[model samples]
Target: MRKITFKTLTKVFLVLVFSTTPSLVLSQVNPSPKPKSDFWNHVQFGGGFGLALGSDYTNITVAPSAVYNFNEKFAFGTALQYSYIDQENFYKSNVFGGSLIGLFNPLPQIQLSLELEEVNVSNTYQDFGEDYKDNFWYTGLYVGAGYRTNNVTIGFRYNLLFDQDIDLYGQAFMPFVRAYF
Candidate 1:
């Protein structure tokens, strides 16, 4: 087996960062002489949720995010994510994570986005009259494209470094929705 070291991990991480940074690193346009008075101006709220309930299974997810639009074509933001799952007589899991998000719109109806995140996941279970808990770090790097409208954004993203065993996003391809405030 190949032993994974911190140095190797760091190099991989740096490469991902550098490759995505350029598109989002452009200079911001100078603001107009008259600024808007409303605090909500140029700001937007967006996120997604999932819920499932059954006799033997329960799952809930709440992900909230905020973004500041630099212009019609550029924006930067952050996201807070949480999810909980329980299976009767089986196990329970909890997840918490946050991501730095960057978005760019090259056209009026198309948007490209990237997100980097670090997630902490914990699971608890009982076996043979014994209880145990496990915790680990799950990192994600995603690249996506969306269809934009006046009030909503619909997108699909693929996690470039998703791990089937540790990541909260169960599938590499995930759909997302966002509404503007």
Candidate 2:
């Protein structure tokens, strides 16, 4: 009968471990193939909506937007906006527009954005006993920053093209909430 010594057993154990370690490392380094991702998988859709109503006033807004994520840090998108406003015996207005958006993320929790917008405004106002109509096109360029979490962002933006005399948005600074899925 033969007996194995502790030193001999330790040598055998070490040989077994060293022989299998390379295969284990190689297997992790060369994993199985994965399926390719689809184009739509990188596209996200989101927007904003608002409604206000009173005895003498009514307002409604709809904005739909979409973005294509090029990577974890960059995205490009577009948005369409429509708004209707009516004030009893005062004025009625329709505003429609579209915008181009570009976004960047410096950190997982911070987002920066640039947007260009063009809108057409048509308004009818009651001047005493008569109606007056005005129509025009307006353009806006905005730069913004926000806090981001998951698919939602809370931010404020400043319009570079805003004019106090024009009264387009009444002010250059605007707060916004954005989300995407």
Candidate 3:
């Protein structure tokens, strides 16, 4: 006669049950493949917002973009954003920009990014036309970093302002926040 200890009995039971039901065993082994690599590759579309600080003007920026996630912590994407500013008491301007971005999320509570961007600024209500609109063409490139937590993302970047300003040709620091979905 043989005596079966509790551990031996449990092993025998599992083998008998699993051998009869492979689906049950397989289900226990797999758990949905790790959540599709962090929203960009999984979600078809997403959006974010920013605050642009410039020497002449400050503006609120909003953008909607398509995201492609490389993994659980990184993404590559593009955004189309419009900007507006209140300049010099009764002066205003509108701008449009496009950015190609790479995002790095080291922790779930924090994210960092670098962006290459092109911007165009158009002043509508100034005293002069081509003279004031001379500041209109703002083709530039920039590198930026960002932080994110609780669905809100904040970021900063320095840009090489190009093809427009002669005397004021320099970089600008921009900080922004947006809801990530």
Candidate 4:
């Protein structure tokens, strides 16, 4: 009688498994190519919305964007933004903006994003006088990353040049979301 050593048994087990497996299993290891689709198939639509209400503060926001994929790895898009804020016994403001956006996907589930925006804001001071309006243009740049799924994405971004003195967005960190059509 012969006893099989551990090393010999491992070698024998591997040989049997490989020899018994069908050649079809090994041949199908390569991934399939992506299907060709129409231009419209690569278009996606989604955006972010915000609402805040309290005795001392009221804010509402509407932002929407459209994205077209140049390829599986790159996309470019645009966004329209509007926000209004009214503070108790203080002031009221209206902000309108538009953004140019770009995205890069190095992996199937990871994304990198960049955005540039121009915002025009109108402010009416209630404490000072009646209908005293101030207007200005603000430029914003953002950089962020997120996780993506077949139909949805969730991400966070930072305002690279946040103006703390202005007090529009008190925090530099902002969240973003998207849904594909």
Instruction: Give the per-residue lDDT digits (tens) of candidate 4, residues 59-174.
Output: 99999888999999999999999999999778899999899999988997988899998999998887555667789998889998989897677888888989888666787889
In terms of lDDT, model 1 sits at: 0.86
Q: Pick the candidate with the highest lDDT.
A: 2
lDDT of each: 0.86, 0.94, 0.67, 0.87
| Lowest-sum lDDT 10-residue window in model 4 | 124-133
Q: Which regions of candidate 1 are displaced past 4 Å?
A: 1-39, 165-167
* Models ranked on lDDT: 2, 4, 1, 3
**True lDDT of residue 58, candidate 2:** 97
In candidate 2, what are the lDDT values of residues 35-83, reduced to their tens digit?
7778899999999999999999999999999999999999999999999
Question: Which runs in model 3 stand beyond 4 Å of their true positions?
Answer: 1-41, 48-61, 86-90, 124-131, 160-171
In the range 1-181, model 3's lDDT, one tens digit per residue, is 8898999999999999978798877778867577564543365466766687777767786788776767769877888878777665445767787878777788876777777766676664556442244354455466656677766677766665543343223437666664556
Clashes of 2: 0
Q: By TM-score, rank the candidates, best first.
A: 2, 1, 4, 3
